[model samples]
Target: MHPVCEVPAPGESLAEVGGVNVHAGPAIDGRDRRRLERLCRYVARPPVAQERLELTPERQRLVYRFKHAWRDGTHAVVLHPHDLIAHFDYRKSKLGMAGR
Candidate 1:
């Protein structure tokens, strides 16, 4: 994972250490149409793309490749097909809420 080097807007703070990044971005500008649209598009994007998802060669487990490798050096997640469904089902809401 590369360290986050984004410069935050005024009044916002951005920091990263050892590939972990934390940022408190400026408050949302509801009046900014472009920004609002960008945020909406991001939230509505698919959680996983078909290209990044595949069944393991043995056909017993699924592998999900990440767009970027994690700081821990994990490039993909391996799971049983059933477990994958359960994981997605647990994230039930449009707002990415888990469980209830």
Candidate 2:
């Protein structure tokens, strides 16, 4: 499996890393899908959901951890799929950097 990069933190979203606006859909493309599928195959079961934390009044972050197998060996990566806005509490004020 290829080396996995560290997950970006809230407010640090970038296009190069497949980060998207909180309300947007998944940032992965066809190539990323293939890589993720290969990684899934290495593990006996599906990936695990690590955490879901609030980043802002409107955005939440979801983290998934998975193991990938390659000719060399197995490796682990934590995937950050963010830009998820929670609609229930829209009236709350945005928090500062240290709040989240």
lDDT of each: 0.75, 0.38
Off by over 4 Å in 2: 1-68, 83-100
* Cα TM-score per model: 0.47, 0.15
Q: For candidate 1, what is the total of clashing residue pairs?
A: 0
**Residues 9-77, model 1: lDDT tens digits:** 656678775433566564678999998888778768887787899988898999999999999999999
Error of 1 at 58 (Å): 1.1
- Record all residue pairs in model 2 with backbone atoms less than 3 Å apart, i.e. clashing: 1-70, 22-83
lDDT of 2 by residue, 1-100 (tens): 2213433665443332222123222345667878668655754552333242223334443432233465566343322342223321231222222223
Error of 2 at 28 (Å): 36
- The lDDT of model 1 is 0.75
